[model samples]
Target: MAARFSLTFDSVDAPVLGAFWKTALGYVDELPPAPSATRAEGLAQFDLPEDDLPEHGVWLCDPDGVGPHLSILNVPEPKTAKNRLHIDVRVPGHGSPDERWARIRAESDRLVRAGASIVDEVDGQHVVMADPEGNEFCVAATSA
Candidate 1:
């Protein structure tokens, strides 16, 4: 039998990262309940009820084109250090480092505007970025 799992990201801003993944993965947003306080409260935040939340949670597809899901979750604590494991995204084509860098930058800019942070730029072949939750992901030039 095949096993399945959901990858979770501890995010300071769950809705932002969730929106990003929703766009990148074609996944729909699970509607959450309104906060207990009335809209005038201005401090009451709301989210999906535990039972109403999707079983799959929030996730996106593997950047490699592999079908594994990448899930992001909201947590109380912030990420204090670099991730022990990371995701690498390969742009599906071949090119020189400069060429690759240009493409990667274009894509990275899009992601940045969408709430991801560019952590670093290395050569023209790769760039390291973090999602709104702070989980690291890299974009690399690829022949595939």
Candidate 2:
């Protein structure tokens, strides 16, 4: 069996970045740990100093429980270059190429409204975009 793991992102503002991805991927904030009523409470229990914890970091999970968990944590430095590994948001459909491209374009537009910026379009197959903090990802149309 394959092991499950999370994808972590370093951000300047974790909650803001987490919100953007949650909207982009249709994910939900992961529930706080047991014995805590809220994420803040859970973090408080750790008793870590402010310096030890990333400001307002958030954890998200796939609503269908299929995709990997996401951890967005704040860091001091800014993004300097292209991502070595990135996400591909696939919007698959059954139709002509134009119809399929429409689906992909619609999703790209929605993501743009959710604080992502378009970087490029590749041969009408995919759109490259960057999150608010400049993390790169793709929106692609695939055969269903």
Candidate 3:
């Protein structure tokens, strides 16, 4: 009962945000239960589609099983305001300030390419960004 619960996101198109976050956060889409597999086991396994197809509901899980799983739920309304609780993508700091900023910017660029838009950047501190759904999150540089 003490284990962390999955983070749920309310979205207009659940699968789109799910897929975006999957790539943005280096997560994988969770698969449904196999014919013979239990529910828990199914949640542990993921499917990689071999062909192009439109997805519906999407749930993302960390491949390393370190972070909480992210599930995007379809909602009728669109995002109108900022999120009260947001995730911070922490990139580990390695060397000097410039080096750390480089690392942070590199990650920021990658996420932007993956469908995130940069909201702003605070010098060498962090890069604030929003997901495809306009949900706000931060790419923070972690201390060494």
CA lDDT, every model vs. true structure? 0.65, 0.90, 0.80
Tell me the deviation in Å of residue 45 in model 2: 4.7
Error of 1 at 133 (Å): 2.9
For model 3, give the 10-residue run with minimal summed lDDT. Answer: 48-57
Clashing pairs in 2: none
Kindly list the per-residue Cα lDDT of model 3 for residues 28-47, writing each as its tens digit. 87655466254344533556
* Candidate 3 ranges with C-alpha deviation above 4 Å: 33-55
Cα error, residue 7 of model 2, in Å, equals 0.6
**Most accurate candidate by lDDT:** 2
Q: Of the pair 1 and 2, which is ahead by TM-score?
A: 2
lDDT of 1 by residue, 27-47 (tens): 554323354333223223446
- Ten residues in a row with the worst lDDT in model 1? 35-44
Top candidate on TM-score is 2
